[model samples]
Target: MTAGRVVLIRAVNVGGAKLPMARLREIAAELGAADVSTYIASGNLLCTPPDDPDAFDRALEQAISDEFGYFREVISRTPAELSQALTDYPFGEAPSGHIYFLTGEPSAEAASDFCSRDFGNGERLQVIGRDLHIDYPAGAGTTKITAAGIAKGLGVTGTGRNLRTTAKLIELAE
Candidate 1:
C-alpha cells in the first residue's frame, strides 16, 4: 500500500546497539506499510507505506526510539538515489581501500577542507551530490583518517562502509 519508493536508514548498527531487521519491518507495518524488507544488518529498509512520507518518517523515528529505548538519526534514500551514489565513486583504486561516507546533506565545501587535512597525499575525495566518496589507496598509511575524522570534518555524522558493503546495499535497494 505504499506510494513512492523505499527509505534507507543509516547507522542503526553502531555502538553495540542493534536494531533487528524484523523490528524495522514491524515499525513500518505499524505505520500502515507493507511489503517491508531489510537488507543486511546496517538498517537498510525497503517498505511499502500507506501514508504521508513526512509523517511516516517521524512516526518511524519515534517508534524506533520507543522500542529501543534510545534515539537514532534516520535518513531516507530512494533506490535511484542509492544507485547514483554508487555511480559517483570514480576512483581507480582497490575497492577495499575505498569507503563511502553517507551524509544526510551535501558538504562539498566542508569535504574539501576534510580532504586537505585528514587525508594524506594521493588520497582523493569527492563530494558529488549528497554522497562523499573517499579513496585511500595507501591503506591509511601515514594517514590517521578515521570515520570519526571524516564525519567531523564534513560537519555531519555518518557510518563509513566499504565499497563491497556499499555495493551490497545498492543491490538490495535495487
Candidate 2:
C-alpha cells in the first residue's frame, strides 16, 4: 500500500540528457500512474506508480530510454522514506547541500573507503543508508564533489537533489 513515490531521474536537463517534463509526466500517466505531476524541469516526478514500485521504476527507466535514447537510472522513494532520510541528514542545517539518492546501499568496505577520503575544506559527505548527504559550503555548482565522484567512491550510481528540492519533494509527496 504505497501512498506516493518521488521519482528522481539522474542528470536530466543538463549536459545532453534532455528529458521534457511534460513528456515525462505523459509517459508516467501512460504507464497507469495516478496523480502524475512534475517539479521544476529537472526530472522530479511525483506519482502513485501503476504497479510494484520497483517494477514501475524500471519500466519508466526503460520507457524514457526508448523514447529519449539515453538510459538514466530512475530512483524512487516513498514520502515516509524521504522524511526519514531528512531526519537522518548528518550535516546539520546548511544553506547549500544535496542528498544523492544512491541506487543501492554501498558495501561496507566501499562506504568505509569512501569516507576515509578527504573531500576538501567546506565540503563534507556521508553515506546514510542509500542516501549520500553532502554539504557544499562553496556552492553546489562549483563544488569539487560530484555525483560521479560519489558513485566511484561508493560503487553505486545516484541522482542528486538540493536540500530545498528534497524538502519540497517531501512536502509535495505528503
Best by lDDT: 2
Each prediction's TM-score against the native? 0.76, 0.94
True lDDT of residue 161, candidate 2: 86
Candidate 1 regions off by >4 Å? 1-6, 51-54, 97-103, 120-123, 138-147
Instruction: Estimate, for each residue in 9-90, the C-alpha lDDT of model 1 and write its tens digit.
Output: 5567777668998888888887887667876778766765676665776688788888887766555566666667667777
lDDT of 2: 0.88
Model 2 Cα lDDT, one tens digit per residue, 65-110: 9999999999999999988888888888877877889999999889
| True-vs-predicted CA distance for residue 77, candidate 1, Å | 1.3
Each candidate: RMSD = 3.5, 1.8
How does model 1 score by TM-score? 0.76
Per-residue error for 99 in candidate 2, Å, reads 0.6
